[model samples]
Target: MAKTLKSAAVFLLFFILILLTNYETNNMVVEAALCKKRSATYPWASCVPLVNDNSCETHCKNKEAAVSGFCDTIELRQGFIDITTCYCQFNC
Candidate 1:
């Protein structure tokens, strides 16, 4: 019984760790996308809407511009993973 309990506890801990890791990864992906999108549209004097805002559909009409901007940003291209780690540390 004690061995079974220990095994169950270990399994539970690993399961929680996996869940948290997955959540963090998903958040990083979303953040990267948003940063790319914002960088793209914020130039050219356009008003970019927040992700949850209803205007996002209209705001993202120029996705190519945003993607191009994302590609050009050295931080996004070279240090994206580190940036995501820092962001996660602060936000999550």
Candidate 2:
């Protein structure tokens, strides 16, 4: 009876571990997809174009002029702000 209980406990522990691992992997995949979608929708300039540029501070200050020169002409305003914010945070 003791041996049987030990075996059952081990099995239960293994099963729970597998379940947790699977849940974690699925969550990672979902998060990656959401990140990709967000990046594609927003692009950097809309949120923080100067991220890669040498003059980030100036670009951020002149957002209206900068956006007008770049994104406004392109007309990709859907998730532009969100994308920019995410990009800036990620870079920072």
Indicate the residue-level lDDT of 44 in model 2: 49
lDDT of 2 at 63: 47
- Least accurate stretch of 10 residues (summed lDDT) in model 1? 83-92
* Candidate 1 similarity to native, TM-score: 0.43
22: Cα error in model 1, Å: 0.6
lDDT minimum window of 10 residues, candidate 2:
83-92
What is the C-alpha lDDT profile of model 2 across 3-24, one tens digit per residue? Answer: 9999999999999999999999
Candidate 2 local distance difference test against the native: 0.49
**Model 2: colliding residue pairs:** 47-84
Q: lDDT of all the models against the reference?
A: 0.44, 0.49
Most lDDT-accurate candidate: 2
TM-score of each: 0.43, 0.45
Estimate, for each residue in 1-92, the C-alpha lDDT of model 1 and write its tens digit: 99999999999999999999999999999997765444322332222234224232234434332212211122446645322110111111
Badly placed stretches (over 4 Å) of model 2 are 39-92
Clashing pairs in 1: 40-66
